[model samples]
Target: MRSSLHVLYLSLANLLITLSITLPSPVQTAGTVLVRRSDDGMWHPERYGGGAPKVNNPPSPGPALAASTIHPIPSPTLLEATGLIPFSAPLETTHPIPSSLPVEPKEPLRTIKEPEPHESPLISADKFNKAMTAANFPVPSSEQHVAFVASTKKAKITSALEAAMYLAHLLWESHGLQEVVERACVNSACPGSYISDLDVKGKRYFGRGYIQLTWAKNYLEASKGIYEDDRLLQHPEMVSENSTVSWETAAWYWGAKVHDAAASGNFGRTTAEINGPLECRGGWSGAEAARSRFRLFTTIAPIFGAPGPFLEAGCY
Candidate 1:
């Protein structure tokens, strides 16, 4: 009985050992454990604190260890069943968008042309006619004198007309028609002169051109300074026929220098004295003609767009 009891006790002990070896190891769901292989090729628990839990069956031959083992989680997608990430974040796109049509560049702006310098502003013809009539010009009842002057002296009728028109404009701007006529008659050898002895023979020393530019020195200087032609002094009649030359001489004579001098109270007498006896003989007495001529100048200055005071003071 003792022998039989000993055999049964040994069998019971062996059975307990076999059960412990065959049963699955207790695995904590929240913790991890590591198992190492023994010489017999069976896995046995080696680390229990913080290693991967032992698999129920020996892991099947997994893919060979990757050359680069570190990997980031894949982007979330509905197709990946094992993936547990939530809503997809916006993708950081880097690809450029393809365009189907080409864009045209804007055209450059065009520049506008400026108006011509010599062109006159729009003014009423009635105003011009009234002004001319007021100045006693009467708009040439016939073109006879204009034609004669043009033919006899090779002068231009158009030039004379332009000069006359320019003068009429001045007269309208300055004093009345009578004042203009009286002023123009000063020292003038025309049909009307305050003194008969001052009148010369056959249109000699007549107020020839616009501004009645007279005196040899004045002619020479004006021709040279304005027209840049020294020979213009010889053909004094050309001043009436040539609008270009006439206007230039007019500008120089009636412009800033004489204007400034007159404004300063000299009245252009001091400068006239420089021309010798023939130019300034009677002194203040002779100045009457000059003063009269200057009055006409003042009257006509407005036509050329000069101010009244400027004309009065000879300020060009």
Candidate 2:
């Protein structure tokens, strides 16, 4: 009975050893990979499986994704067309996406304040009336006086001398601001065919405005400078018909061409600017007119309190 019992124990021990060698692990039988906790504290596929799951052991990394294989989200237009989003609705996102469109920088506009009615300076009404009386010019209406002051200011006639010189020219050309349009001869002897196109409309560019602005080209240029268009060319009579337009055109011409020469106190130089071909050259046909202009300048200068012994008036 003892020998039989001993034999059974020996046999039982041998059977246990064989079972342990031949039987598969629970995970292996389930066909699942053994997982270990990584440094990030997450469970991942283990390097090898035999003992308990590791705390920090991690598997080798897989192949990386290619740049070409990556895709971006559809454009707003495409998404709207496909009915993914309502038309004109703003796109929603987890993160605020930066705009790819270029932003244009805008320039700030400059503003100029308009002057008040009584804001006349340098060329005051009392002084102008005195000057007109002294020059034997016709007494201008109150409206005419105001218009003259405004026009001078627009021409940037800051000094008394500039005012006197400008007035002298206007007095000579416009006949003391009485005749806005030139008194041209009716016959073919008069200056009418300056620009053939202007004559087609019966628009004579002989002489008009305060400085007697002549020629179609001058009218066109002044129109562009003042109105920023060719309206003056089309309606040449506006230079004489519209007082504001007339005065502004003269002011534009003075500021652009004659102001600098007048500032030099050289009467003849200013004459040359107005009619160089006719009056400036020695022994020219309009030498008499040049002398007349000089006389007017000398006469008006003292009235406006301009300091003299001025330069002798001649083209040279």
Candidate 3:
């Protein structure tokens, strides 16, 4: 025990001597220490710190170690997410080898997709309807309005202008006629003009279809020419129920020969031609029904680019 104490004191004194060596004037830190170091201020293989591999001067060739004396280098891949490489001691290998092959970079994560929306309404189905409504247009029937829209493309009528004019008159004939009579012809009663003349063979025929297919003779003649069936003379209400037949009858009256009075866009004159005998009998200004027809034409004409009424009458 006394000899072992003397040996421990010699070892401690040798450690103190090794630690007293200072860095040389040329020594500076690069990534790892590049300068050769010695213990006890003398040249020898005992480096103070775990020394770096030599740069300008390689380390001396070492003797092959016995297999049992070797240790595996710590793998860089063993690092935890804390970014620490756990090594209980200095990293060393049986032979100098590359530190864990250059760490491979990772790819980024994928994101979810979303739906896209449309930008403009120029190609929408209700584009025309919305525009006309914004302009405060009084569209008649949806069916008739569609006809007007279609006319802008292919023009089943002469033009959209003609379709507008045609639809305006039809609108008045079917929906606005009563209002016209109530507003102005209250005293004269335009529909009652043919009072006794309205019935034939016990089936009282009032104004029934577009433009009011009034009078039994008119119904019989229209049904024969337009439907090729005279049955409407006895059942005139069928005219109101069958829109196609009613409109066909009106078209027939419009295109049948020529009423010079309806020539061109003489709107007031057209009113006179269509129902003058009943409503315009008192003269233009007094003809409320004629004036109402003109009112509708004025509102609808511009939408279809129809020229304004070239000839003005007091009724318009």
Candidate 4:
């Protein structure tokens, strides 16, 4: 009976050991990743975490690893799922992209600089016509005023002093823009030398345009400078016939010869450049003409903002 009891006890112990070895391990679902023990004695992920549903589309296995060292191949989806490379955050209204970028200027830097001392805003038509009237000039039509202003701007004559001197010359020379040609030459009895130009089939280049542009050579040069051709020499009458051309020719002359002198604040120096040989000399006639030029400048200049007691009067 004792031997039989001992045999039963040994059988029970062996059965308990077999049951412990054969029964499965308890499944854990607490962590972020589902893992399993491998033959290599490493815990490897079976599936991603975050309650992701199981699918048949398991990731392909990487190259075989050695016993001790292992590096899991990071698939793009695996990296995203594992929080290694996190998903982009949701866009917010708090921060927005800019609509426009800074742009560089197309013009040269020098061209955009502030106006110089000699520069000023152009005078208005009302002011110009009023100044003309004040200087005993005819109240020029609006069209005439526009033509003159355009011409002056084209020549870059923007200063009040220069415009004052220029208009004075015009007033004296053209008699307030009333006469286009020299009155002395009106009857074709202009001095013989004035008629000596053989060009233009007997068309004389005697004192035409607002400044009374004289000489065939002057007509030719003005034509080249203004029209880029011989139009003025070919047809000198165009200067008188076309009002715009008349004003432009005078502006061209002022810009080329008289601008610097007028800018110097010397009225006599300006007259010397225009008709120095005749008008700048101190004869009775010259003095009278100088006085007239001075008087006209004084009258019209103040209207254009030129301060007076202007002392610069005579060329001599």
Candidate 5:
């Protein structure tokens, strides 16, 4: 009897191990395996001859799903169409099943600010006057306007800002009224001998034109810059006789040397360019003239669409 019992126990142990390997992992609803110590000291499937329900094959994993940022709950219509739930069941209500869907928290929307549009480089004569008035500079005359537009066009002063600054300089120079003819020099005896090379036998070349192209040499140089001619040196009154000649000579000075000063919007620098060393030189008169020019720059800045002539206007 002892030998028989040992054989039966061994057999039972073998069966249990074989059953565990064949079956899938035990799940919550799946029935549990049972055992009984036989009277003969042997074990089989179970006391009543029952075992885990026979499974032909393990369940296959479905196709992999792509990950998503916003996890959308499956709509009831989708589940119904797929026959996931009972056909007799009611459709999805406004309220969702708590366990069926994830609670997606909302995020705030973002926005951005845009910059405002700016003005163009150039403006019309009408607009130019309006801007000058806004800056407290008086409007130019019709004749002054004609001369300004004509001369500046020739000098490549295309922008309204450029025209405005050029007009401002002319205003201060001769108040838009220049004596184009050569006049008496600082000294009566030195009528036209400002430059030794200009002191010709029968010629008088003193201050003339808008900004006054003075000295015999200046007349010669200015005519070359104006129209590439030297007749102005011999007959200097041609600048006064011809309106175009007068404006052209002035434009030549502006485009040649004083253009950069105007670009800076510093009237003092432009003034210094016109009258050497007088801007921040000499005595009281020189100092006063310099101050006045600096102020003019600030005042005319707005006409050119500048924020202001608030930049440093010192001699440098």
Candidate 6:
């Protein structure tokens, strides 16, 4: 019985070995093997079947190809129009950026305000008259003397008064008392008629106004920064009508070297005393007129805080 059992076991083992050699293994069913085509267009399995899908015929290739390579095709026009192109790439450009271009920051809006107007410096007639009265001279009875004095040789009344007033103020500021100038005016020998003409040789010379700014050379020089013409010196009355011109001329005369001697001291005492001389020529009498004219300045000085001759005499 043991012998028969051994022979049966040997037969069973041989049958198992034959089945293993004929049928595919379990590993073959788990994976696939690739099949490649030959140049002749025939396909043959390169590896044993491992439960993979079957391919019937080899695919035809027109050109030689590299292993593991791919070729991309252009997108269809219809697909591009519909914005459905697959794997579309963006284009690259090479434009340069401008260096001066400013990047403005956005700001919220706001409101703004406007500016105001300006005013002038002219004084009123009442204030001027009052100022003159305060200086201590009797006001002229009529514009007559002022007018005659101004019109003496084509001199404008307004211009004469303005010049007279300007000189009076300057003199008053330079001198503490207006009486000194008044005394010079009443006593001086300078001709009144000649004082009206503005021409150098026309007779009227250095009539009214400060320093008796006489002579064509002196007038011309004084007028340099003051008036357009030195002829105004020939007719000193123009200084009154034209305030700007009058002030400029006054400043120049008072500050000049030629008049330095007479203009010395706070009251311009030297000039007043000189004008007081009776033997003087030309507008020497006008110096006395200037003294009278100074009365107006004396009256006005307090109101304007103008310095007396003493205070105004020193160089600034």
lDDT for each residue of candidate 1 in 6-74, tens digit (9 for 90 to 100) = 878876764554455543244211122233444554545532222233344334331222121211223
Give candidates' CA RMSD values in order: 21.4, 17.7, 14.6, 13.7, 19.0, 22.9
Better-scoring candidate (lDDT), 3 or 6:
3
Cα lDDT listed for each candidate: 0.40, 0.68, 0.50, 0.69, 0.57, 0.40
What is candidate 3's CA lDDT for residue 14?
54
Better of 5 and 6 by TM-score: 5
Candidate 5 residue runs with Cα over 4 Å from true position: 1-123, 127-141, 158-161, 178-195, 310-316
lDDT of 1: 0.40
User: Candidate 2 clashing pairs?
Assistant: none
- RMSD over all Cα atoms, model 4: 13.7
What is the descending TM-score order? Answer: 4, 2, 5, 3, 1, 6
Model 1 alpha-carbon miss at residue 156, Å? 26
Q: How does model 2 fare in lDDT?
A: 0.68
Model 4, TM vs. native: 0.59
Off by over 4 Å in 6: 1-129, 133-212, 225-244, 257-265, 268-301, 306-316
Better of 2 and 4 by TM-score: 4
How much is the lDDT of residue 250 in candidate 1? 46
TM-score of each: 0.33, 0.58, 0.45, 0.59, 0.51, 0.30
The per-residue C-alpha lDDT of model 6 at residue 171 equals: 45
> Tens digit of lDDT per residue, candidate 2, span 81-178?
45544222132333443333223467777687876676546766787888888889877788877888888877878888878888888888888888
Q: List the residue pairs that clash in candidate 3.
A: none
What digit string (tens of lDDT, one per residue) describes model 6 on residues 1-316? 9999977876676445335433322222111333444555343443221223343332332223223211122224433444432322221212321222233567866656555554322333344455545655454333423332332222211222233334354445324222212233434524553342335554434333333444445556666655566556555445434544444554555444423343332333433433434322336565555455344544554554444442223211
**For residues 151-238, what per-residue lDDT tens digits would candidate 3 score against the true structure?**
3233124544454445456667766322212223334435444445435544555666556666677878877876687888768667
Best by lDDT: 4
In angstroms, how far off is 137's CA in candidate 1? Answer: 3.3
How big is the positional error of residue 82 in model 1, measured in Å on the Cα after superposition?
A: 50
